[model samples]
Structure formats: structure tokens, C-alpha cells
Target: MSEILRLDAVSRHFSGLKALSGVTLRIDKGEVLGLIGPNGAGKTTLVNAVSGVTPASSGKITFMGRDITGIKTYQAARLGLARTFQIVQPFAEFTALDNVAAAALFSQPGESLKSAREEARAHLAFVGLEAQAGQSAATLTLAMRKRLELAKALAMKPKLLFLDEVNAGLNSAEVERATQLIHQLAASGITIVMIEHLMKVVLNVCTRIAVLHNGVLIADGPPREIIKNPAVVDAYLGHQYAQRNAAHG
Candidate 1:
């Protein structure tokens, strides 16, 4: 697979406090890479830097061989990058269908409104929100809102998708369904980079895992190998038993 996204020694600082420190990673087309870390690990900051939600302090970001560092957020979207916020933000006044339609309007490449809405409808159905399409966004439950968010992002037809803590507030069953939805997205050949706190969701949805601690990437590898890294375990993998054993040994 070709390299779709590259963050070369990327760093972000907020008023002298480092949020991401020399984070370098590459994502290939059609790969699902999990960003796993404890709270305050700068996982979301990394995503923001890549998506142009915030500019990086240093280093470089390239998407599809083009320099995209410090570009505007909408530019990132237009460059085939899309993201879902940790907090669901739908247009309260619009119906769920219109929320997705708005995204289509933004993504429309000189397409008509009728065409955009048609695509939006398909995306909503893909995310299993076809029934609630006409319902107002403010009236949907958390799970429905999440699905609508996915539909909106998908409507933009992004080559690379960033999901920020998407499973943070979901129940077990909802998480499972979300995992299935992610799998379907992956199966359709979209590359994904997600900041996920739920280990189950991370392990199940990602073929590779990247672990961050204190705004630094400490480990990047397959799930099995990442789970065994002493640093990763100590930081976020819940391996206290192993750490205690090693201490005794």
C-alpha cells in the first residue's frame, strides 16, 4: 500500500507546554491504526495537528505526497481527510438527514443539491440511521447522534478518517455495534487513525496500535506486540501484574 499520511517529527506546543513531542508516524492506504493512550497523552492533539484543527509547532505533515501542514481545517477536508469529534456536534436546528446533507454540500464537487442529498441519504443508511433521517438532530439519543456523526463524515468521502475517542461514552452493546461499523468502513478500503480509550474497541478494530504517553509515542506495532511492551503496558496497557512480577524477579 502507498503512504497516505505522514507526520514527520511532528510537535505541537501550547504556550510552552508540549502537547505532542516529535511524534513521527506513517499511515498506509487501507490500514486501521489505533492511537491508544491514557488521558493527557496528546493523542487528540496529534489528530488535531494532522487535521488542521490546530497547526503544528514544528516538523512536517504530508498527505498523499502533498505538504499539508498548517492548512485550514476545511482544506484538510477538501484534501480527502475527515474526522469525528469526541463530543458529538450536530446542527440542532436541522434534521439528522439535513445534518448529513450539510456535509454533502461542503463535499460537493460542483454537484447539485439533489445529488448531494442523494449521497447523504446513502451514507445515512450505511450508518444505519435511515429510519431517523427526518428526526431533528437535537432529539436523537447518544448512539443515534454518534451514528449521524459517522454518516456526516462518510458523506464527505474521505480517504483518511480520524476518529477521536469515539467510544468514550458508549455502552457495551453500542460499542460493539460501533466496532462493527468501523470494520465495515475498513473493509471498504478507507484508512483510519483513531484515538481510542476503550481497549476492547482499539484491539478489535485496529490491525496496528500506536501508544502515546505524556504526549510522546512510546510504542507502535501490531496489537499482540504492543500489548507486550513493558513501557506500553506500564503506561496504558494495564500490565501492573507483569510490572510487579518483573520487580520481584
Candidate 2:
């Protein structure tokens, strides 16, 4: 596969804390890579840095062979890099269609509101939110809101997508639905990097896994291998998880 993104010795510091430390990684086109780590492991921080929400203190980030280390969030969106927040934040007053339309309008230069709304309808439908398009965003349930966030991201027309804990706070059925959407996205040939806690979802949707610990990457490999890796098991996946996985295998 061709390389789609590369991070070379990327580090981000906040005051005296190192949120990311010399994190070098590469993402291939059409890959579904699960980024797994315990709480405070800097997974979201890494995504923020790459998506230009938070600029890296030092090092480089290249997306589609273009340097994007210090680009603003809108610039990243325009460059086909889009991400969903771990905490879903929609404009409460805006209708679902308008919410997505805003994403389409701002991300792509020269896009008009009329065309954006038309495009938003398709994206909302893609995420199974077409019926709720006219409803106020605050009226949607958590599951619907999550799908709306995905619709908004899709409206940006991202080439590389970052899904940050998209399945958080979801029930089994909801998680399955989200997983199916991810599978479809991956099948559509979008390169995805997802930060997910549910091992089942990660294993089901991701082609490869990368584990972070204390602001550093400790393991990067296939799901089966990552589950058995000592460093990963120690840092995040515990002994119980390993034994359970072994039994299931």
C-alpha cells in the first residue's frame, strides 16, 4: 500500500508535561489502524497534533506527502484530514442538516450553503440520519448524535479520518452499528485511524493496532500479535484480556 501519512519524531509539550514523546509512525492508504492505550496515554493528544488541533512542539507531520505540522484545524480539514471529537459537541440550536452543512461549507472553499445542504443530506443519509436531518441536534439521542458527528466529518470529504472513541458510552447494539459504519468506511478505501477502548470493536474493525503508553508507542502490529505482546499486555491489555483472547482464538 502507498503511504498516506507519516509522523517523524513528533513531540508535544504542555508546560512541563510531555503529551507526546518522539512518536514516529506511518499510515498506509486504505488502512484501518486502531490506536489503543490506557487513559492518559496521549492517544487523543496524538490525534490532535496530527489534525492541527494542537501543534506539535517539535518534529514533522506529513499528510499526502505535504507538510502539515503547524497547519490550523480548518486548514487540515481543507486538506482532507478530518476527525470526530471524543466528546460530541454539536451546535445545539442548529438542525442536524444545518450542522453537517456547516462542516461542508467551511471545509471546502467556494462551497455555497445551498450546495452544502444538498451534500449534507447525502452524508446524513450515509450515516443513517436522514430522517433526523430537520430535528434540532440537541434533541437527538447519544447514538444519533454520534452518527451525526460522523456525518459532519464525512461532509468534510476526508481522505484520512480520525475517529476518537466513537463507540464510547454506547451499548452493544449501538457499538455494532458503529462498527458496521466503520467497516463500510474502510471498504470505501478511506484511511482511518481510530482511538478506541473496546478491544472487541478494535479487533473487529481494525487491520492493525498500535499501543501507546506514557506518551510513547510500545507496540505496533496485527491485532493477534498485539494482544500477545508483553509490553501491550502490561501497559494496557491485562492478563485477563490475554487469557480470554487466547481462549476465544
Candidate 3:
């Protein structure tokens, strides 16, 4: 598989506090890479920089062999990179189809509204929102809203998709559905880089897992090894078990 995206020595600072430190990673064609970390680990920041939601302090970002550093978000979208926000932001007043249509409009190549809406309907169905297409986005349940967000991102027809904390607020069943959809997307040839808090979701869908702690990458390996990393256990899982273990000890 070819390299679809590369982040070289990526670093970001806010008021002298480092949010991401020399984070270098690559997304290869047809791979699902998981970004896992405790809160404040800079997982979202890394995604933001790649998606051009924020300018990186120092880094080189390349997409499909083209330098895309500091490019506008929409331009990045046009370049076959799409992303979903941690917080699902839909056009509340619009129908599910309309919300997707808005995304399609932004992704439209030749500036035709008709063609965009036509494409949007297909994406909504792809995310399993076809039955709710005519309902207002505001009226949808949380799970449905999440699916709509996925549909909106998919409407961009991305070669590489960045999902940030997509499973954060979902129940087990919803997360399972989301995971299956992600698998489907991967099967259809979309390389995915997902930042998720739900360990199960990451382990189930990702081929490789990348762990971050205090804005630094500490582990990059398969799920089995990653979950066993002493560093990862120290950073996130220690507190939950240390007290209990001490009580028993």
C-alpha cells in the first residue's frame, strides 16, 4: 500500500505549552490506525492540525505526495481528506438529507447544487440514515446524529478520513454499529485515522494502535501489545486500579 498521508516532526504550542511534540506518523493506503490517549494527550490537536482546523507551529504535512501544510480546511477536503468533529454539529433546522446536502455542496467539484444534493442522498443511505432522511436533524436521537455526522463526512468522498472521538458518547450498541460502519468504509478502500476514547472500538476496528500521553506518543503497536504497555497503564489505567490493588494488598 502507498503512503496516503504523512506528518513529519509535527509540533504545536499554545502560549508556550506544547500540545503536540514532534509527533510523526503516517497513514498508509487501506489501513485503519487508531489514536488512543487519556484526556489532554493532544489526540484532537493532532487531528486538527492535519485537517487544517488549526495551523501547526512547525510541521510538514503531505497528502498523496503533495505538500498540504497550512492549507485551508476546505481545500484539504477537496484534496480527498475529510473529518468528523468530536461534537456532532448538524444544521438543526434542516432534514437529515439537507444536512448531508450541505456537506455535499461544500464537497461539490463543479459548483452545482443539484448534483450535490443528488450525491448527498447516497451518502446518507451509506450511513444508514435513509429512513430518517426526511426528518429534521434536530429531532434525531444522539445515535442518529452521530450517524449523520459520519454521512456528512462521507459525502466528501474522502480517500482518507479523520474521525475525532466519534464513539465518545455512544452506548454499546451504537458504538458497535459505528464500528461496523467504519469497517465497511475501510472495506470500500477508505483509509481511516480514528481518535477514540472507547478502547473496545479502537481494538475492534484498528489494524494498529497509537497511544499518546501528555501530548507525546509513547506506544505504537498492535492492540494486544498496546493494551499491555506499562507506560500506557501508568498514564491512564493506573489510577483506576492502583487504589483497589493497594486495598487488597
TM-scores for every predicted model? 0.95, 0.99, 0.93
- Candidate 1 lDDT score relative to the true structure: 0.89
**Candidate 1 residue runs with Cα over 4 Å from true position:** 240-249
Better of 2 and 3 by lDDT: 2
> Of the pair 1 and 3, which is ahead by TM-score?
1
Q: Output the number of the lDDT-best candidate.
A: 2
lDDT of 3 by residue, 56-144 (tens): 89989999999988988889888888999988989999999888888877876675777777777898888888999899999999889
Q: Pairing residues by index, what is the TM-score of model 1?
A: 0.95
Tens-digit lDDT track of model 1 for 169-236: 88999998889999999999999998887766787889999988988989999987887788987887
lDDT, candidate 2, equals 0.95
Clashes of each: 0, 0, 0
Please tell me which model should have the higher TM-score, number 2 or number 3. Answer: 2
Worst 10 residues of 2 by lDDT: 105-114
